[model samples]
Target: MNLELLESFGQNYPEEADGTLDCISMALTCTFNSWSRDGHKLVSASTDNIVSQWDVLSGDCDQRFRFPSPILKVQYHPRDQNKVLVCPMKSAPVMLTLSDSKHVVLP
Candidate 1:
């Protein structure tokens, strides 16, 4: 299967709280609780421990990021969009480098 990133402003719906937390690709049922804009690109986070990036012109998700814990909010660095701030519900916010996923600077 192709692993292309697909994300954008998605409408959310309520679902039964099952025994598991989804951390996979979000179809239309994913609800974005927090979001931030970086030029023409959009970055958003949800309760599914996923962070997705989308192109504004086409409304297509270009990439999806995963975290160990559920994401509460996300923000793009003011100077560099590649550097993202991921705030988890149970942990401190981390500054992640999208290119390598190596950095974990404390927030």
Candidate 2:
């Protein structure tokens, strides 16, 4: 599938110099981890220890979650949409709730 850029937002923080906010002395630090569900919504985890939920059609971030460590991978539950699994680079996968953005490590 082909995708086009619509809008851009700063990762981790809204007022950061991510080229979208501060264009004078910019720093493009946010990188994509390639995690998507169909073509409607996607989850992007950056090196800033942040996971962002995106709306494919509108190119808007619907929600944001801050993890304890930098997120390595993100996956949605097979049977549950509200529950997501986020794996940090130095640790195991943790359960994340989409409603409140609460994350709990699985034992």
Candidate 3:
């Protein structure tokens, strides 16, 4: 695994920096689902049981949603740009509708 350490300036710097910590233990998994209609937002999830909408251009976490169990997988809807499917390890998968109001329970 090629682990790159980011600098304080949030840029990729040399590995042999003056004071760089070599070890990190944060349990997180992330993947991009799809781009928003406005081309500004991206949907991503982590093992920490959190789903977040990120800004692709600015590289910022814009919105977050917490699940009851650790998120196992996440994917975007093919036809509708605003919908996503989230699968948790312990529970049934859920379909989240993008207007941020409706959720469909799936088996």
Candidate 4:
């Protein structure tokens, strides 16, 4: 796959943006979850054991949540603002609840 890193605002392309993440083995698909009002953060997952929360405004990964198995899909809850659903390829789905004070892991 061809990789190109654009500017923070995605309005222009940088000339020297060729860094790749070595942790990702295979990226099947990715989607943006619009949970925040400012639209700054996005959750992305791959066939690897990593789930990443990226900052679109800064073009950097803010936080990463790792899984025991390879992640098949990731999605944000529609009604709940602090919940994310993660599905693995071989196991049952997991619910990750993110709040201001604590992080809850549910099976």
Estimated TM-score for each candidate: 0.58, 0.62, 0.62, 0.55
lDDT value for candidate 3?
0.76
State each model's CA lDDT, in order. Answer: 0.72, 0.74, 0.76, 0.67
Clashes of each: 3, 0, 0, 0
Give the runs in model 3 whose Cα sits over 4 Å from its true position: 1-40
In candidate 2, stretches whose alpha carbon ends up further than 4 angstroms from where it belongs are 1-38
Which order, best to worst by TM-score? 3, 2, 1, 4
lDDT at residue 35 of model 4 (Cα atoms): 41
In model 2, the number of clashes is 0
Cα RMSD for candidates in order: 16.2, 15.0, 11.2, 13.1
User: Can you write out model 3's per-residue Cα lDDT over 1-107, one digit (the tens) per residue?
Assistant: 53453325476678786886665787565743656666777888776778887778999986678888887777767667678888888889999886764789897
Model 4 lDDT-worst window of ten: 29-38
After aligning candidate 2 to the native by TM-score, how far in Å is the CA of 6 from where it should be?
A: 45
Give candidate 2's whole-model lDDT. 0.74
Ranking of models by lDDT = 3, 2, 1, 4
